[model samples]
Target: MRKLSLLFSISFFSLYSFSQSGTMQYSGGKSADKAAVLIVPFEPFMYISEIDRQVGLENNLDGKAVKSEFAKALDLYLYQTFNEQFQVLSFYFMEDDVEQDLTYVYRSRKLEYEVLPEESTPKAEEKLKGIQTKLSKTFKKEEDESAYGGQIVTERDEKNKFMNAIISDQKVVDSLNNRYNASLYLLINQLEFRNVYGDFTQMEGNTYDRIAKVHYTLYSRRGTVVSKGLATTPFPASDNNLESITSTYFPILAEQIFNAVNMDITSTKN
Candidate 1:
């Protein structure tokens, strides 16, 4: 009886331990390689928009807020998606650090700018002249306005060109070769955000919605572009619920970025 009781207790404990291991299983895409990957902290860039900038400008939110939220979401997704196969390392690069080792940088020159509400009529034309002056100081005009709200516009201007060039300088490349021993670098240029608004009359009173579109590019360490990916996600502004929406969508955005990187790595390996 004693021997049997001991055996049963041991079996129970073993089962409990197995259940508590907290191991995650990945059954989604192809597995990642087991080799260690140094993921440089994703550098954040600007998207020209009033709403996008307001998150930091008026809300008193800083870059750390954005970084923290992104890191949390990305860490969770990566763990679920790749933990079983690859060992991931955080490569946090400060401005100084990146300046010392960056090999290739990504820069975007805006090719379009359009204000909603056509500037065709005399009154509209006058309003546009003022808007154009302000815009010209900031953004270059690519083409004349066609439609009022949903028209496409193109413009050319340098927003963060200087910083990007410095990151891709020869000095940075030499440092990367000497210090981190990194062979590959990724650059995301031109992550664009466009605002879309709509109104509808329905049984439930009125409905309004806003959406955002993102465009980006990926480049290799040696200045070879690996891939380009774009994502358009909806962001509804209802009673200041922007933060919650941002939290939800950022994970999706991170996943899209990860997918781009994974594809590039696979292509290079093949």
Candidate 2:
């Protein structure tokens, strides 16, 4: 009986570990002391999955509204967590002046990378749009021309879009740094909520585990880039709401992010 119990425990532990996976990638283990970091308002990946768009059409979903809510939740969490040492100051954006339009990317079991706009948009109107838009839309199938569209999303795209938005906001970052008495600025280039498979991947499977990825760049007060870091939850996918990802899985990732900050700041002597 004891042996059976021990075996069960080991099995469960292994499965738990296998389900949660993440990484922390950064450059320069240097430091930045007295760094009152400015956390610019978070941005979503300027992306809309075909599925999300259709669901929006059916359910009247507003991607920006959804993202705004997510941003608020995330900002509150970060403030509560990091305000002490870093003097974390957050900004909320109301208007965006970026000229580029948001694009949709189709992800599915077969494809493993981002499908370019020129590659996927036109077929959205074709019969077998989105998922059914064929491996290559050029080889149009006259029979399936009546099919509608669909879409899929991954964590990577969200991260990229968020990062790009901040990169474009360089004009304002310098001012914020000075006003906040910040020696460093922490901006999340990407903070996305997505479901991962129990297999720690999105390829296909029924296990709806949840995971999040955050890409941040720390800049000096003068706007000189210091370090870029990534922190992902070591949790599997779930049907849970986005807010819970931070409460449930972010402790570990948060620690890594702050650790990177300390490593950078503390390593640099006065």
Candidate 3:
């Protein structure tokens, strides 16, 4: 009886280990304990307070540099954080054909990678037309606010649209899968830093409560969405020092995003 119990224990342990290893196909059928994830290049969008903007101007700071630094920092922290949960992360740049060894590729077609407000204005017009059809011709257009379309498309919306477009395009999806052999694809769509303390124009403190919003989408090899949302972290606002922002704020943002991804994965499994 004891011998039979020992045999059963061994069998259970082996099965557990096998199950713990990644179930998805990775790196040409090699067994991976963690899911292989492919990350798209980071796209950043900044809407800083007037005070911060002035600070940036005084310091000769530009959005491009800040965006690039944040991208690298987030990429590094993401790998470090996700490494605890999985391994095999890589990056893919849509405009660049050269492949890099970094923990995040080539692209066939050039993508604008942005959705301008003008592009979505036509859809609003169509909707208005439909409503007009339901009403009488006498419905005078009183300078429709929708025609102005002040709706700010948030990062979350942008990510959704971008992911949907990519998923529908079979060629892009297939090409990535062939090259990366990764089942999970993550795109860091946009990052935003907002001043949470009073009006943007009136804020005059050296440090104020600020929130960092990171929008992302995680999809499967078949384009099935695993997780999609914005991860936000609050920090004390400071100067636009690249090193300061990276070292102080990025890890916090990374941790928040990591928790979000991990939660989603667990929820999906359940």
lDDT of 2 by residue, 1-270 (tens): 333234433433332221011111111222223345656533343222222232234333344443444455555556545644655444432222211111111110011122223322221123212211112122222232122211224323221222322233454555444334556667665564443323323335534334455556666776555655555553443233333444565555556567766776666543
Q: Alpha carbon lDDT of residue 120, candidate 2?
A: 23
Please say which candidate is ahead in lDDT: 1 or 3: 3
Give lDDT per model, in order: 0.37, 0.41, 0.48
Candidate 3, run of 10 with poorest lDDT: 17-26
Off by over 4 Å in 3: 1-33, 44-61, 92-96, 99-166, 199-202
User: How does candidate 2 fare on TM-score?
Assistant: 0.50
Q: How well does candidate 3 match the true structure in TM-score terms?
A: 0.57
Better of 1 and 2 by TM-score: 2
How are the candidates ranked when ordered by TM-score, highest leading? 3, 2, 1
Rate residue 184 of model 3 by lDDT: 80
**Candidates' RMSD to native:** 15.4, 15.9, 16.7
What is the model-wide C-alpha lDDT for candidate 3? Answer: 0.48
For residues 86-163, what per-residue lDDT tens digits would candidate 3 score against the true structure?
654445222233233222212232223433244333232333233221211232222432321111233222121222
**How many residue pairs clash in each candidate at the backbone level?**
6, 18, 2
Q: Any idea what lDDT model 1 has?
A: 0.37
